[model samples]
Target: MAPVSVVMVGIGGYGAEYVAALDRLPLEKIRLTGAVEPFPTRSCAEPGLSERQIPVFPSLEALFQAGCEADLVVIASPIHHHISQSMLALNHGCDVLCDKPLGASIQEASALIRAREASGHSVRIGYQWSYSEGIRSLKRDIQAGRFGGPIRMKSVCLWPRTLAYYRRNDWAGRLRDVTTGRWILDSPLNNALAHFLHNLFFLLGPAVGLSARPLEVTAEVCRVNSIESFDTVACRARASGDVEVLFYGSHATQDSYGPRFELEFEEAIVAYKTPVGDVKDEISIEADGRRVGIYPSPNAGDHFAKLTEAVRAVTGNEPVECGPEAAAAQTLCMNGVHESISEIPTVSSTLRRRSVQPDRYWIDGLDGDLRRCYERGVLPSEAGVSWAIKGQTIDLVNYDHFPTSENHA
Candidate 1:
């Protein structure tokens, strides 16, 4: 109601984007109370926030003590800090709007879910694609049977990350192991492809839960440069969702064709292939050997704007579409791809939908040592390895990238 009180964590890069969204929104409806950054020296010394008037607290607790009673805690923190920061915020009675890939692993994500349930507060994962006007229109059309009885889904995501991209930040390839004080890639799936997978389910609805499972997955991990993690991952997932669904995504390419999402159904083909800009939500559907086109009504908000609405829903005691449960399901799908990649069994096995096992391979050491490092929340270099995860592992990887100075310059 009264301008959802808000505190933001990590005000650099993506965090800065949230800051701008908060500023652009009705300031009277959402207030930026305070912010938290561990490196106050770097943050304060940086010229980006020179004009920002809000006080910058060095710790989460410090902000709370300073009377920052926020109804919303928007975590734009690093991928690793997302879970911990979200837990702290919910525990402190603040509703949360988290960046995508809520946690590195489903295990970590479960902890956040437990916290939210215990606190009885709302939590929204930042899968803004599900909220996009274009996506919503497509979903509506599909439900209306505009595409006919059976539907097939196809997701194409091809983007290039140059060697310079990884060299730009020390944390780029560095794994954060909270266990054994070591860094590992145990959570790569979430950090990399959570949104892409989740958007599929959001559009289609309970895909894996029903009659079909991901029968087989063929993945190709390409190392375009020195980044420990795969700079480009192309996967072809074959599943039985109503008819059959073939999905593909590749994050390595100089020539990217479309907006990273498209769907082909039994009747017609619907696509969203423009760059990241405003576009009319239009779909071409064919049924019974007849073709039809539909245009979506106009809406004022983009992804972040939809996120603000979710925050309001949480504050108003309403259920969130992208809540923890949905997030966990998304995480499960993400881990499925990771597990498939790791356990590249010479023989493929058929299992029920949503099957996840405890993965220590993602940790270093055959034993619990790497898990211990991850639980301790130490950076990768401290864990005696450059990067470690189940399906992929690399040693002595280079973290040199464009300097922060250059990024700002």
Candidate 2:
């Protein structure tokens, strides 16, 4: 077998991960064809494309126009650029591994699905956790009916972002891209902490490569930061089969805690990063009122499995574990969330505390409160938080298309 020629879109930010992975992969099995980055920064200078003599183009369109033959194209571009680039790659008879939250809306995701079908090529979404054998093992058990009827599942993550973090890119804290006016919806729910949010639906997926659809979403969204979009959110979604999914994500905190989750099933309760010291990082399961120790975990840290799986999928004609249809669930919930809370509120000034070093602000007691909500299986509104705002519910059944308007104001 010959080496699979690969092209990468977006070589800065998270694109650096793909670059390093490509470098680490065996050269005989993987050949670097080119890259698409209008501005190649020094951040990706180490063992860099320049040193490797890998050709870098200004855009994916340019690469394809130059007839850069590639079997696979890895996209780590801005959220707004995903659909366009993936469609181009597919049109050029190349497989795609576009990055996560597939796009800002379910409609965009559907278009990519259509493109994949039309092109007769593999199109994988880069949700690394979905490619993990550990998570796959967990999902298998759930699908096998070992966990019994689903009750409820909730996840909480409070990762603090500094001023510079938001300032690094134009889309960081935005509800839409500034220049392109495309729906970005870059927030903790959709961006940094999306793995946990998407995991809930992915695990509950009836099949190996699908996710539970969010039928309706209710959410409270606010920001303490100096950004256009909300940095904190508490969302409750009613998925298919009457399963409840709750997600609490916030970047407006100093205390960094959790990407933790607790999933309740009739026969057992499963948790990740639970308060239990002995099994903090493992997928801990408690069945029939007794706790079972952690199972042999999946090597989730080997995120390059996303790329490797995509390579295997195309070269070996294997099914992609996470495709456009599977990734659309997260986009659906995100679209409904924005519609549910069109008016993003500002967290109470009195409750927010400012910090130095990077000029960030945080809601006092928020991290602890979110952790408490996770343990208690409740939303922040139900937990009686002083600054919590109740939001409307938006139905998402047969939901498609996200109106590109300033609704998040």
Candidate 3:
């Protein structure tokens, strides 16, 4: 097929990384047409990247007007602008690959999903960890019955953020209301906790539907640098299958231990020790009481690289890795976590099918979910998983590990 023409919507932190990933794809399969950053000065105005000559525009509208037609749009913009930008891209017949969290709110995310469905274009969210060589190797092993069936899973995602971190960006800890214009990021649930929530569903596949409300969650949220948002969060939750999952994310510490993912079974412990960044692409499975290290691919490409492939899939008329079900399930999981904290109980009922459209922005329902969870102790689980419908734990066990590392703040 002709190389899938694509554009990077944002040229900031993740945006820069996305550009790097796009550079790694086969030149024939991918083409870097251009980029759209509202703030050309702010996006790639820096010294080094500017000289690369990848044509940076000041607005999405401007990019479209420049007669630059592309098959896909890769968004690395802030959480605040994800939905709007993605919607516009889809409207223009461009597929989208948004950064994780889908949107700052459920409604916005739902709206973006709706737009994708309406446009009949593919939309893939960025959760590069899922595309990791480590994850792929473990997936191969799991499918091959290497460490038996997945008995349990655990993750210690210590992503530290100092006071300066939030202060650095205006939208860092914001609760935005697109209609009325109100925003705040008062806790770790949305920003930091979001990473883990997305990965949980990523590693486990979308076989399990996520309940809109958190079933059970007990978290100790703390504020370290006087930021309005919680710097540290440690909580445990039970999702659609009554599957107990643990979550801990923080923005208070000076140093972060990075994100660590592990899956345990009766046979052995399969773990992926992920430090922050694009390095370390080895998957190690400790089965039969011994650690067997396997290197799947050294080129654990960044989000842009995988996103390029997704775009190619879109133009080529193939399925997407970050499809609707996966995106919705992930957003649902995030809602569950936030609701669990605020006491909003959610039930996953497949019987209730709603069109994937964002009539309401996500942040709008945060307070409501929290209040409901507190009022109703029993959260409704999505009725699909036989393991969940049967009310049986499915013989899965989980362990939470957060040892004190030298990088602790």
Candidate 4:
């Protein structure tokens, strides 16, 4: 068959990583045909694109207007543009591979589901962990009853960010785009550490296909930074099969723990822990009184590799491993988190604040407090913080019954 043609939207930052991954693939399998980047000469200019001689367009609309056709469209654009861009690509008779946090709001997510059903084109979300070989192996073990069914699952991460990180773009830490008036919940649970949360849901059951859906969620969202969204969050959700899921993440710490996910089964415990900000890690399983480590093969964590697989699946008219249905649980959990809190409460002045650098602030003792929460497998309130507020519970058994309003707006 001819090489599958791909057009990328966005070519800077994370987009550049995609370009490097695509470059490593065999040219006869997939080829880059075009890009949508308004400032190609700026930070977005990538050597891979220049070397491949891919044409650049100012926007997706511009590329479509030029009558350029592609077999697949990969969108690495901002969080707020995902749904619109994915719909545009599907309308043009192209399958889509969009970045995570499928949509900024539940309403937008529902709309994308509707569009995909109407277009009959495959749509995949960029949740790299869901595509990792190590994760897949773990799923197989769970399905084979190696662990004798999961009892509970926990995902914890403590990643710190400087104020400049939020300043990278106008939408970095915003809840709503002032220019487009669209909802953009750029928070820890939704954007930065979303993969960990999504992976927790993916591990419950139905391992080979779409992940288990969320049934309910109770969460507490707090903020110490000046951003519109919360920097610290703790959530407990119930998934299909009566499995309980716990998530605790924060961007307000002085120390970083990277990301760790643990699943406790009736007979064994499966865990994956990595250095801060690293996704490529091995899984350790303790079953039948024996411990074993499973290492991922080369390029197992390469998101571009997963994207290429999705493209191949679409070309072959096969089902993608991480499609729209697999990602719906994430959207429901995120929306439920926001619904749990009417407004984000700020930390009390008792928490010491130190000026790390110009425009950057760090909360003293926050790292230890967060670690305590993880060790105890509880939320901040349950961890004995005087200022912590109890979270609200939400039932998502009837997902469509949840409110679709822009909570932050």
Q: For every model in order, what is the number of clashing pairs? A: 26, 0, 22, 0
Candidate 4 structure quality by residue, lDDT tens digits, 302-334: 656568777687668665777767777878898
Sort all candidates by lDDT, best to worst: 2, 4, 3, 1
Cα lDDT, model 3, residue 370: 28
Candidate 1 lDDT over residue span 1-409, tens digit each: 4777788888766777777777777767776778887764454323444456777887787888887778889887767678888999988988888888766555677788789889988778887765666666666666677676445555444443344545544556444443443333422345555566666656665431111234444443333334455443433444445443333333333334333444667666665444346655444444455645644422225758555775567546554666666665455444444444543221111210111231101111212322233234322234553232223321101211112123357
Q: Against the true structure, candidate 4 has what lDDT?
A: 0.80
Give Cα-based local distance difference scores for all models: 0.54, 0.83, 0.55, 0.80
lDDT tens digits, residues 130-157, model 3? Answer: 5666555555555566666554555554
Runs of candidate 2 exceeding 4 Å displacement: 274-280, 298-301, 404-409
**TM-scores of the models, in the given order?**
0.70, 0.95, 0.69, 0.91
Q: Give the poorly placed runs of model 1, Cα more than 4 Å off.
A: 40-53, 65-67, 141-151, 174-194, 206-218, 238-245, 275-283, 287-291, 295-301, 314-318, 342-409
Candidate 2 lowest-lDDT run of ten: 292-301
TM-score of 1: 0.70
lDDT of 3 at 153: 55
lDDT of 1: 0.54
Per-residue lDDT of candidate 2, residues 27-141 (tens digit): 8888988998878864554347888787788899889888888999999988888988999999999999998868787777888889889999999888887887778888889
lDDT of 4 at 171: 86
Predictions: Cα RMSD each: 13.8, 2.3, 13.4, 3.0
Q: Name the best candidate (by lDDT).
A: 2
